[model samples]
Target: MDFETEQATRYQRIIDLLSPPDGTPTSTAKLEGELEGESDDIHEAITDLIAFGELELVNSSQHGRVRLHQPTPSTKAQATLTDPTEYVWHAYITERDGLGRTRARRLFKDREVAEEHLKQIVNVETLTPVPGIKKVWCASLGSKGYTPEYAVLRREPVFQQADDPYPESR
Candidate 1:
């Protein structure tokens, strides 16, 4: 996970620990030991949570006693703390030469995004500057354990100079 996600998830954990009747005011030293982080980082997280209105310091002079101020965090805050979903869907846009050999391929996480990219390539909506783009297509891929299977979702002819260009050349 990236730093932001990691930090937010940690913040969520803190909220869960200190929110409600189950939780009581805890010292900063005890929280740092529980979290297993540098004193500075723990202090920073505590300060941030306090500013976010999820936590409050019970003793300003002690600067170590803290408790949850809000039982529930906002939806936006929860969203930042949510774990990223695994991507099972894979889409691709491929470029082929006259010899029916793949010249290039690009992967996308979404099918529609891949199809839109393929459309741009086929229509010359974007300048590729490729000399001979005989065919282009969008393909969906699936994986089962170690094996991968591909199925073409969309195909379009591009600069087709010949119906069969050097058919036996390969």
Candidate 2:
């Protein structure tokens, strides 16, 4: 399948996994396990949905797989789309490069703070220096707005930037 088609499928898979009704089933562990087998593209999709305020991250493996919390004034909810997608992506970028793995629990810990950062950066897509990688390095703000949001993430850059411009195969 093509890129867009593949993305649609990935989104559906995650949605179906998290479709459990209110209070009846709140376990998101199984869903997480299933995606654990997915390719990197799906991983980035998950990150995108989570960042777009459509999915929630969980702590205990037995917690809600993902949630579609209703937006409310009380939930600190806001319209995420009117804002720039690139700005949100940049929230994931490090202050400085040349780093190893580091987990930031509550990855979007400061959603509003990150959104502010998003608005500041003029070109968020420029943050991604590697090829064939999802432009998820910078994206929108908010966790799709789950109460006590739990849209956690565990992403690692699979592609590294080359010092030279030519491809290794070429």
Writing each residue's lDDT as its tens digit, candidate 1 over 62-103 gives 446777653322333333323423222222322211111122
Q: Which stretches of candidate 1 lie over 4 Å from their true place?
A: 1-3, 37-40, 71-170
Best by lDDT: 1
Query: Least accurate stretch of 10 residues (summed lDDT) in model 2?
Result: 94-103
> How does candidate 1 score on lDDT?
0.42
TM-score of 1: 0.36
Stretches off by above 4 angstroms in model 2 are 1-3, 20-28, 32-43, 61-65, 72-119, 122-170
Local accuracy by lDDT, each model? 0.42, 0.38
Worst 10 residues of 1 by lDDT: 127-136
